[model samples]
Target: MFDIYLPIAGMQFNALILVAIGFSVGVLGGFFGVGGAWVVTPALNAFGFPMAYAIGTDLAHIFGKSIVATAKHRKMGNVDMKLGLISIVGSVIGVEIGARNVMYLTKLGIAGPVVRYIYMFMLFGLGIYMLYDYMTKDKRAAAQAAKVAAAARAGLAPPAKKSWNLPPMIHFPASGITISLWTVSGVFLFTGYLSGLLGVGGGFIRMPALIYLIGCPTAIAVGTDLFSVLFSGAYGCFTYGIKARVEIIAAILMLVGAAIGAQVGVTAVKYIRGYGIRLLFAIMVILAGISVSLKQFQLNTASQWMVMCAALGMCAVIMIKLYQGFKKEQAEKAGYAVKEVKP
Candidate 1:
């Protein structure tokens, strides 16, 4: 029973449905270090919200949800405040430049198709690369695991350290990394430009960049990306509010659910490994690419259905993984408790 008056969307909807959608996306955002607006906007549109209102309301809720998730990550020592702040500065400039490019292309009367093509290329390229990384890493991890096991059996020491050792290095204490300043700037600048060009929160792009480019641990990348998402989402909320596109009542309802989901998602990250996150994220983004391609072909119904399925399907998979990990941890704790009881 959708029954809430949303002034901006100019409609009534089941508040619980909004909450459910928010919760699903919130889990993804918290776990994957993205704003998950790509999931949210289309889901809302499926529920009959005006496209503009859907985007605005989703961003508004994302601002609040990011706050919740970021605070939790900070406590977990996952967030690197220095890196996050620098990212904000670089991204803002990048976003502006990206926006300018869009405007220029629009003037050329080929903006829509061009943007769609870029979007398709970016998603497909990133997804394919991540998939490749995951496959290659499996072989590497297996070899390393075998070597370590053999060493322990033979009473030999562990492997030697190899340094990245890039010059003009900058240290992020929270992420426990020292990488080149140019690398950091270039990463954020490119991600920010993509955000501006695609009119997105850029969490998905930034999260991968943090992992593969800057070489942050997966957990830290999730935390740090959420930190960036917080500011970006807040800015989106404010901008949409001024434009009268945000539906406050609906957004508030969604925020309630998002808060809870963010907690679960963040906790799930503790249980999952870096590889697991990458594999799932790669799959998710590939689905998103399919959605965009469908849209480009003017298959409107197919596009919406594809995105909704991707959003919901991915959310379900995340929740199941979280639950499985949580149960395993609980069983381990129980075993420890029994052992400590000593007959």
Candidate 2:
């Protein structure tokens, strides 16, 4: 009933499915500070859209959604403007390189399987590492504390934290870090390359890099990454459009749902803690990897259903957390008011 003809891609697709996919990713994107292209591209492809068209349409929608997500993050003081600006310089150049590579691969008639395999590898590798990091954080913290205490007892200075500390260090007071300019640029460039290659905003990779590599706090990482994503998404959309890969009607339908969903996702960030967000992100990506794997194995129907179900399930979890947190906050406010009146 909701089917619509897309002239750009020359296909009939369900409008409701596009909107639903957008809403799911919108919530995930706003909370996770990702463009959610990882989700959108795969979901679209599974449902019969061509790989190139899926990527272009995904990037186009991401550009609009990031605006809403970034604005909300900025208001919450999570954005680091300085870091975000630096990221754009490297990212833009890197994206151009990656986009050209995709075009070459598309011409070879091997874009589909090749892209899916790479996507699966990235999702699984990153997700596993994050889970391991979360599991070992406390042990690592204790070990570092012990080393400091040992040094102090021996009348020696505390052990120095190791870093590159190359010349021309840059300081970001918002994230409370001072690091080499080279390191920041290198990280963004690599992420941008992946963004162009994989039809992502680079937020999934960059968010983790900001926290682990650059030493930004997780929340700051989320906000700052979104700021960077805004630029990359814009560039990606334009480049893909020029390549004649974008489906304009599909992009618009997705954007409508994303706009509303972004608001809810951003608000949920207030209720969830930094570690909580990381854990959820890890799980989401791992599930995404599995979905892509199913596609690689020729189980197209199963892959389509798996991704849609996972997106809906994750969205439900986030909304429930938000509701619970809101109720608790209200109760505390009411209790405080009662105590003040009694006095």
Candidate 3:
């Protein structure tokens, strides 16, 4: 069904399939501030991509996609450069350590299963937890609103800082917060370690961690995560490039699709509510878990079907959301124009 050249993955792949995969993952990466390697690598492998080339090609595309997404997000005032740089520093160190550990595990002959199981557990557990959080989000929002009212009535100062206050505090003007350096480093290091070990951009982990742990706004979390992914993906590309795993031609095609998809996704973010984004993300991850499980059980065909369907389904939802959002935004602008003219 496809053709290949040495060190190049599926040079003759169904061009539509490759483009679709690239576009879908690009949208996800833009929306979630991740490189989407977790999805792309597996999808490529399922579609006859060389195992070695899959990851490298995925990373190569990710680097390009991240650039597109980050640039757009930056214009939208979503990126926090200070936090992003810190993430890079911590993640780079963590990645080295994690990679070394993986090498050690590989020597024991249980590395493959161990890594796969860990990936599965993380996906399922994170999915469930996010779903639960989404279900209870309204209650939490109401409680916070009540707290704000009570504070206003009491004439108390706005909420006090509750950050852990570990040493070496760093302030981020863009994010409008100050956090302990230790907390920042520790969080990025852990996420970075996961990235290296799992051969992912760690956007899933980093984005969630940014929202819940670092306490960044959802938009900022997405932007900052993408910034970090750019660096990590570049490093990955280089590593795999030296090993002759990166297919430049395939990566170029994917990059074109990703560029367009990233714009759609970044624009959609402006229209969607934070909770809505979280809900969609939870569903996507849960389905990803099912796909991974199928793969783990040696049901390659089933795994591919599940993943492709899930991805296509989710992509449809995102595009629809983006369309609706664009329409609504446009209507509001038209109304504003009419009002100004009347006055």
Compare the candidates by TM-score and give the number of the best one.
3
List clashing residue pairs in candidate 3.
none
Sort all candidates by lDDT, best to worst.
Answer: 1, 2, 3
| Clashes in predicted model 2 | 0
Name the candidate, 1 or 2, with the larger TM-score value: 1
Candidate 3 global TM-score = 0.93
Write the residue-wise lDDT of candidate 3 on 1-343 in tens digits: 5443433553567667677789998888888777887678778888788778888888999998999999999999999999999899898888888888899999998788888898899889989998999999889889888888889999996576476997789999888888999999999999889877876778998998998889888889888889888888888889889998998878887898888889888888898887788888888888888988988999977887787788778778888999998888899999999999995
lDDT of each: 0.90, 0.88, 0.85
> For residues 10-124, what per-residue lDDT tens digits would candidate 1 score against the true structure?
7889989999988888888888999988888888897788898999899999999999999999998899999999999989999999999999999999889998999999999
Error of 1 at 275 (Å): 0.4
Show the colliding residue pairs in model 1. Answer: 2-13, 2-14, 3-13
TM-score list, all predictions: 0.92, 0.89, 0.93
Model 2 regions lying over 4 Å from their true place: 1-14, 45-53, 99-117, 243-245
Q: Where is the poorest 10-residue window by lDDT in model 3? A: 2-11
Every model: Cα RMSD to truth? 3.2, 2.7, 2.2
Writing each residue's lDDT as its tens digit, candidate 2 over 114-155 gives 778888999999899899988898999999999999999999
